[model samples]
Target chain A: MIGELELILCDIGNTTFHFLIDDVEQKYFLNERLPDFNETIYYISVNDNATANLKHSNDDLVDLEQYVNFKTKYKGMGLDRKIACIGYDDAIIVDAGSAITVDIMKKAKHKGGFILPGLKSIKDLYPKISHKLQFDFNTKVNLDKIPLCTQDAISYAILQSIIEPIKKIRKKQQIIFTGGDGEFLSKYFENSIYKKDLIFENMKRIINANNCIA
Target chain B: MIGELELILCDIGNTTFHFLIDDVEQKYFLNERLPDFNETIYYISVNDNATANLKHSNDDLVDLEQYVNFKTKYKGMGLDRKIACIGYDDAIIVDAGSAITVDIMKKAKHKGGFILPGLKSIKDLYPKISHKLQFDFNTKVNLDKIPLCTQDAISYAILQSIIEPIKKIRKKQQIIFTGGDGEFLSKYFENSIYKKDLIFENMKRIINANNCIA
Candidate 1:
């Protein structure tokens, strides 16, 4: 392994683009901006436009697929899911952001996963389907019981949509929560661990694996 | 009550407007066109734009709020919710369409409800948030477990999102499923009864109640 290797980790999601360099995280609207970088760039994206924005040359921008070694039923397995599998011996990795993905990785074997619209995405959905229907996702609400008003009702419903299914499939494996909404979810699932800069950690692992292969 | 009186039942939903006259159901796209009707009109709506389109003087078009008698925690109680509570002793009424609403009416008491984005709306959400991301809701997929591809994964997740929560809070009350997606959900919840023209039946109930009041 090179002692002075410069690394930049990029995670391109549907709603937001995230980059981690020197342990500092930078966020941008997906496909809006593409930064000029000199370091080795490694990225994983679910969105094609975001990937296009990050595209330079085939050799320069390394997609997570270049390093992740796994077989799954999901033909086009999302890079985030692959990263979530890394370093987890047996876990249910949940990435709750523009989209909510719940993947189960047991003993390095990809079991399968569920993908649903994220809370903010679900909030945006109401107005689009119905005219003049307004929703506020920033407002705090109680999820223990049902709500009366429109705002609270939507908030509780979105939270429950993710939580209810995970609760029903109560696996013995550790639950790893990541992404922008990860911290908020940690409060509800006391056993779950909220991880920050997971993409960066995964990038390092990928680099290590590549070095071994070389 | 006059034995020769005419009745026109209207259900104004987020996406489609439904009308029942002479025991035949007529469907139209909401806000697209306004139908000319001379018979006594009865309508229920959650959408203001759809409601505004149906407005024909004050007395001519009757809102469900005027006929249905019930107290709910929701200040602007959606007409669909109110109508769902009608003609039921103890029931869990689920309306799955542009928006899914699961309302609890136990012993004729409104016990609040859960509202989440519907199937088609959830499918549309992906492309709205991401420019290149397109999802097809019509694609058939397995809902009993998680899926592999993005399309199947999304389809399964949306179905599970609605089914899992309702399954958790399994009350002994009769479960009544309605709306465009009602038939599909009926297949999942075998114990539940599928009611196609529930809004029309509720309209009849409201008319009976209004007659008693008069």
Candidate 2:
């Protein structure tokens, strides 16, 4: 078995590289200097540039995509998303980052999933539409009541657009929220679990199951 | 009462000028040469440059923002939205143009409303996120079931995000759909009416009510 001290898991997205080391989380931008660690890093990357850059470096890296055996019907699904769904028998996994991906797993089999623009994406979108629509989204706005002002209107729209479909697809399955914006979105659900170390935890599981470590 | 033949109504948005004359609708690009018409035109515009350009011309034009007297608490609400909500007493008025505006009216009193990025805005948004996400939105995708493919996933997200909120806010109040994408969105709801000339019809009603025409 791989000791906790020797295990390092990295999830590289389009803009950032997130690392899990000995129960501690560390994050760095894609363009930032790589951390020099003696341990072999088991990583799954969605960014091609970052993947190529890391492979060329001296850091002993093991690409974990080969070991993920989740049965999903979603073709061209992101590696990060598939990794997050590991060990779940039944769940609605929501990875809310630059893009919010919602996937349903039943009896350890991936049913299907959909994606929506994240909060930052929606926030950046309004200004391009019109100067009048250039307002900060009020995330605290009450969703039950329709908005009376522009700020709330925009806020309500963003929240409702994301939350409603999740509620529609949900049926007694516990929603597992992960990624950057996961906690914020999980607050809206009653039977949802916010797992900050979801991907890394599952990565560790995959590492143990496959006996990849020496 | 002003005869329909004598009244010329124009709803000017950011990109195009939509005119209703003698029950026939005509559209023109904002950059295109202005139509030379003999009749005095009564118009409501959300585009500042188009409004300024029209005002500078020799054609007789009347701005209709001053004539609307609906009671609403929504501050900085667009004149086009307010004009569309003119005739509806108890309904959810949806204007799905460049931006989708949803306003609720209860017994001639404007309760509240919200704004959402329209279909075109969402379509343009995907390619910017990632080239892999560059797929045309499938409007006919079944919103009742979660999507399995990327194309259906995107299409489901757009439709569900827009439609679900309208359904949630709806409680026997007839949903009134207007604007460019109004007809497309209205098909999802049972208790909804698609009014292609909703703004123009309300503009004409305001003219008749206020006796603006001499």
Candidate 3:
């Protein structure tokens, strides 16, 4: 708890914010708005939600820092994702939210990622407008067949988008899920770990590796 | 070869006509012109590329005889899907293509399905419309991440919509895959069978079921 942890991770995106104390710890709450539990170096995330594009209020941000007492590598990163990869090691982080952020981290460096819309947005577009059917997009359930309406179709489209690609990627690397839809997406994408507290977990991993004195 | 086969089954839709002379025989050819195929059953799909709705075509009514040959039960059904569910006892058919079609068959009958736009539609909608570098969708080969593009987003959404519902409904069932985009989707959905020749298989199934004899 005292002599452990290395980096602070902050991931922000559509729907929610996920922050953490260290690589092995759970993300508490970043100020109420930031989403992370702390802003310490032990955290991990693609984009710092607590400080991302459309984060909530500032009060939430302060609440998160009490745990570790640190700040991100950069404030207001061009993209929250940049914040996630700032100082991470070899690993792939997936931010599944309003948009899916796919990024890579190797040798303590972040590589640019692909930014696409999320399950909710894509499904809502077609089902609500064209198919003219009322199906619940957020409703989490297993369906054997397609819904006979517009909404369900939209919902199905968005989720499939994420699954299809991951299935195609041929890398046998460490995969972590973060962001609002992260937890939800975890249920579907196979063999992937869900990191609701990504920053905290990454921080702990880094700290353990480097023997941080935080 | 001719004597062993009892009948010939033909499927006409927006894109092509599937022919099945028997369980072991099948053929598929691109659709050329309307009121063209020699088959009695004409399944009409008024998609964007369909010319069936055009006032220019006068003698193209598939009518009752067509339905009789196609089984009045399958009339007005989604062409690709109807043929897909023909033989499965329990399964969901995902026709991933320019547009996505997720249809499920349960207990050897059409249990209906959901429809939504495909990945391409989502990508094409933006960028060209907004100079703000809007996120596009895609199904990249990143097994540990989601796509970040309009096309991939659409793809994910569709996949989720289909998987979520089917996963819940099947209780315990086999998921089926077909159509142009079937391969792309099957890889992600996993634990599913793909019928590259679903229409033809269906034609054979139907023709053989009725011992379709001239």
Q: Per-residue lDDT of B93-130 in model 3, one digit per residue for the tens? A: 76665466766666766665656565556555444332
Q: Write down the worst ten-residue block by lDDT for model 3 chain B.
A: B63-72
**Which one is best on TM-score?**
2
Docking class of 2: medium
What is the C-alpha lDDT profile of model 1 across A99-150, one tens digit per residue? 7788888787777887767777777777776554577773468765667777
Give per-residue CA lDDT, model 2, range A1-214, as digits (tens). Answer: 6564567888888877888887678888878888678778899998889877766653698888898876777888988888888878899999998788999998888988898887788888887888889998787999988899999999998899899988888899999999779999999999998998888888888888988886
Model 3 docking category: incorrect
Give the CA lDDT, 0 to 100, for residue B18 in model 3.
44
Interface RMSD of each: 2.0, 1.0, 7.4
Residue-level lDDT of model 3, residues A10-82, one tens digit each, is 4442334443333333433434433323333332233344354323422233222223332323222333455
Candidate 2 lDDT tens digits, B1-67: 7664577888888778888887788888988787568778899988899887776663688888888
- How many collisions per candidate? 0, 0, 85
Ranking by lDDT: 2, 1, 3
CA lDDT of A123 in candidate 3?
54
Interface RMSD of 3: 7.4
Regions of model 1 farther than 4 Å from truth = A1-6, A12-17, A27-36, A42-64, A138-140, A212-214, B1-6, B13-17, B29-36, B43-64, B130-135, B138-140, B212-214
Fraction of true contacts kept, per model? 0.74, 0.79, 0.20
